[model samples]
Target: MMNICIKTVLLIFLSQIPVCFSYAEFKTDCSVPQSLNTKMILFSVDEEYSLYSPEVIGLIEFHFKEKSFINNVIQSQYVFPGNYDYQVIDKDLAIISIKEVVGNLVSKYQILLVCISDIQGYFIYSLEHGERMPNVHRDTGLYILR
Candidate 1:
């Protein structure tokens, strides 16, 4: 009887090992994105693209030169995924920008892309609009998208 009790206890403990490991895996999978200085949580590409209107996507793709940049944006967690303003600078140039407010402070980030060419694009982040250039020297904070 004692042998059977020991075997049951061991089985229960072994079964819980996978559960613990799974929880750890889940936490890592949903982990936040990283920035150079500030803490920012950019949205997942799939979420951003899906949230964007079809027309907006077309407009962005139309002037965005770097196709890979779009893929990178979609795959990267560099900007918050939320409402944005799109503007057409030229026939083949466009910008997508967003503003995020934390407490009473607001920050802006923009993506400049070419519509018809395969040129490289840029991701810009700043505490104020037209106040500072986008670089790795800003104090960004935790970005959470649900």
Candidate 2:
């Protein structure tokens, strides 16, 4: 009888292992254009593609080109996703710059890809504050979608 009880207890404990592991996995979904990898959560962000004044997009690409990882992220090829309901600033409509001046260029447009992931988990993590791994041992590169 005691042997049977011990076997039953062990069986229950073993059965719970997978559940425990699943919780530890800490997986989440990466937004549009972003693909979750073992290292970074990469997704695209949208902005006006102006050749005359490329400052807006330049700034964003410049940062990533540096390839700096913290919390949990890495470097990769970036791309635009789709058209979005993006707007520049909290203002009116359409910004047509003559030369170098950034103000309200975005009026519900382009969708860019942004990919990011956790170095430790190899799973998609939430970009929010609490969604990060409990104890991130390494630097995770968390980039904002422009």
Provide backbone clash counts, one per model.
11, 28
Error of 1 at 144 (Å): 23
lDDT of each: 0.33, 0.26
lDDT of 2 by residue, 1-146 (tens): 45555556766677753222333245344333222122233322223433322222221222122222222112334422212122222111111111111243322212222223222111111221112233111122224433
lDDT of 1: 0.33
**Over 4 Å off, model 1:** 1-79, 103-105, 115-146
- Give model 2's TM-score versus the native structure: 0.18
Predicted structure 1, TM vs. truth: 0.28
TM-score, per-candidate, Cα-based: 0.28, 0.18
Which digits, one per residue and each the tens of the lDDT, describe model 1 over residues 1-146? 45555556766677743222222333212211111122222321212322121111211121122111221133233332233555665444445565544455455656543322222322322323423333222221222221
Name the best candidate (by lDDT). 1
